[model samples]
Target: MAALTTDSAKTDPLIRITDLTFIYPGSVKPVLRQLNLDFHQGERVGIMAPNGSGKTTLFYLLMGLLKPDSGTIEIFGKPVRSEKEFENIRKRIGMLFQDSDDQLFSPTVLEDVAFGPLNLGKKPAEAKLIARDTLNQLGLEGFENRVTHKLSGGEKRLVSLATVLAMEPEVLLLDEPSNGLDEETKTRLITHLSDLDLSYMIISHDHDFLYELAQSNYTMKNGQLEPMERMHIHYHSHPHTSHRH
Candidate 1:
C-alpha cells in the first residue's frame, strides 16, 4: 500500500467541508448548520465542544452514515455526491465511536479485529496476521481469544482500536477515546495515539489529551468551529485547561 506522499497528498485535501448542513429526519432545526472546514494530510486535530453540540453528528456525516440536507463534502479531493463516492472514501477512513462496545460486537477479540480485513476480502489467514499484529502493537499479546464482553472497559477499547487498525486507513477519527478508561489505560491510550503517523481527528473535552496529542485545536460552538490562539501553544502552556469541564 502506498503512503500518502506530501506532493500527491497536497493535490487533494484529505477532507473538505464547505457550507455543510445536516438535519435529522423529522427534525426542525438543523443539527449541523453551514459548516466550513478543511483537513490536510498528516495533521492531528482536536474537536472540542460540550454534549449535544453536534460533535457525534459531524462524525457520522464525515463517515457518510448520514447525508447533509444541502451542502458539499469532499473526501480525498473527490466530490462526495453519491453512495459510490462514499464507498470509495470509506475504505480509506477508520472511525471509532464514543463507546467501544458499539464497535466490538464480535464474540472474541481476535474475531472482532479480523472482521474488517475479512470483509475487505482478505484471506482468513492474512486477516488473522493483521489482527494479531495490531493486538500486539497495542500491548494486548494474548487476550485475542478472550470474549469481548468479558474484557475490561480499557481492554475493550484496545480491541476496538485493533479492529480499525487492521484496515490500515489513511485517516483515523476518534470520538471520546478516553471515556470510561482508568488512569493507567488512559495514559497507555494517549501514548499509543501519539505514535500514530496517519491523519487524525479527535473529539474530546479532555484538554490535556488534546494539548499533548493534537497539532491543532478547534472549538465547536454554535454550530461552528473556531480556532483559539492556544492551538499553536505548547502543551505546558495551558496546564490542563479542560480539567474543570
Candidate 2:
C-alpha cells in the first residue's frame, strides 16, 4: 500500500470552512449553519447524518457547485468563489456521486473509466492505459470490454470508482459509496479504499465501514457539524475540542 501524504501536517490546511451557511431556494429553513471544519493532507474524515441533514449540500459547497449564502471556503489556503476557480481546484479533487448511473455512460467499462483522463487532455492511448491500470487496481482486470449497463450493482460501483481513480485525484469526496453492495463486495471495496494514497472525506451511513477508514468522525445535527463521540476528539489538531450532546 502507498503511504499517505503528510505535507499539511507541519504546513497549512488543504481545506477550510468558516461560518458556512446555505439553504435551498424556496426552503423555509437553512440546511447548514455556522459550520467550521479543517481537513489536512492525506487524512480520511468520515461524516454521518440522517436523511435531509445536508451532507450532500456540504459536498456541493466544498466543490463550489452550490454557492453558500454566507461565510467562506478555502482550498489550499486560497478562497475559491467562482466557477473558474473551483474548476481549477477540481483538478486536484475528485468526487464520486452516490448513484453509479450518474457517472457511468459509456457503453464499455474501459471507456467510462478513461473518460476523466481524456477530458484532462491525456492522449487516447494514455487514457486507456490509465483506465486499465485503475481497473486492475480494483481487481477488475477482465472488465475492460464489459457493457456497463449489463454489470451487476456491485460491478457498477467498482467501475464508477475506477473512473474517479483514473483521474489520479489528490483529494477524494465519496458520497454513500457502499449504498447497494452486498457484504462481499462491500468488503472488497473497503479493502481497496483503505490502500489509497490520498486524502478523502467520506459521507456514508455505514457506521462499520466508516469506522474502518476514518481516524475520527463527525455528524450533522440541527445543521451543526459536531463530534460523533462525546469526547469530541479531532485528529487534525491537538487539544480535543469541547463535546456537546
Candidate 3:
C-alpha cells in the first residue's frame, strides 16, 4: 500500500521507518507488514484505528520498548540498532503510557515529575526546577507538594504528562491522553497541548479531540497506515457516529 505522508515527512523526517515488520510472540501472523512512516519535526499527527489494530505496538516499536522483527527505524538521521543507540534516542523523545498510574510512583507529585530529569543525571535541585516548571506549564503550579495518589484522574493524567515534559524532549508520543478526563479537564488538556510548540503524535479513540488537534491524520488497517480525512463536524454532534477510514 502507498503510505500517506505529509510534505515535511518527505523533505525532513525526524522519525523515519523503512520496510518495518513485526510479529508478536506466540503469534503466527505478522502485525506489521513492510510498513513505512515518516513523522516530521513540528508536526501534530493523530493515529487512529479500530481496536487491536497494532496502533500501540507501532508506538512501542518506535520507542525501542519492543524490537522489530525486521526493518530500520531512524531518528535524526541515525539508525537505531542497539540499546545504547535507543537510550540516546529516547532522551530526545518522551512517551506517555496509556495508564497514568504506571508512570507516577513517588509519594509526592513533584518528586514523581522530577524522576525523569533526575534519571537523566541532573542534580536534585536542577531536576526539581525542571519539574516545577513543567507542572506550571500545564497549569498545575501549586501541585508540587500534593500527594500523588489523592489527585483526581485528570490531575493524575496531567501530572504523568508533566513527568514526561520535564525531560525536555523534542518529540512527544501521547497515547490515550484523554482517557479518564472529564469534558472540562479534557478541554484544559487540549488548550495546554495546543500551546506546546513541538513535534508530537497523539493516539486516541476520541475522534473529535483528534480532529481539533491534528493537522494530518492516519488510520491503520491490514498492517498498514494510510491517510484519512476528518469527518465533517456535523456528523459527530448528531447520532450518525460514522467516520472516515
Per-residue C-alpha lDDT of model 3 across residues 207-240, encoded as one tens digit per residue: 7678768888888888888888656321354464
> In angstroms, how far off is 142's CA in candidate 1?
0.4
- Which residues of candidate 3, in runs, are more than 4 Å off? 1-10, 232-245
Give me candidate 2's TM-score against the actual structure: 0.89
Residue pairs in candidate 3 whose N, alpha carbon or C atoms collide under 3 angstroms: none
Question: Candidate 2, after superposition: displacement of residue 76 in Å?
Answer: 1.5
Per-residue CA lDDT of candidate 2, range 1-245, in tens?
Answer: 13323643556789989889998999979899888988888789989889999999999999989999998999998999999999988888989999999889999999999999999999999999999999999999999999999999999999999999899999999999989899899989899999999899999887667867887788998787887772343323434365321
- TM per prediction: 0.89, 0.89, 0.91
CA deviation > 4 Å runs, candidate 2? 1-9, 230-245
| Clash totals in order | 0, 0, 0
Clash-forming residue pairs, model 1: none
lDDT of 1 by residue, 1-245 (tens): 25646554545678889988888898788878898888888989988878888888988888888888888988877778777888777788999988988999999999999999999999999999999999999999998899999999999888898898889999999999888888789889999998887899999888777877888888777777777567343335455665552
Residue 240 CA displacement from its true place in model 1, Å: 8.5
Model 2: which ten-residue window has the lowest total lDDT? 230-239
Q: Candidate 2 local accuracy as lDDT?
A: 0.89
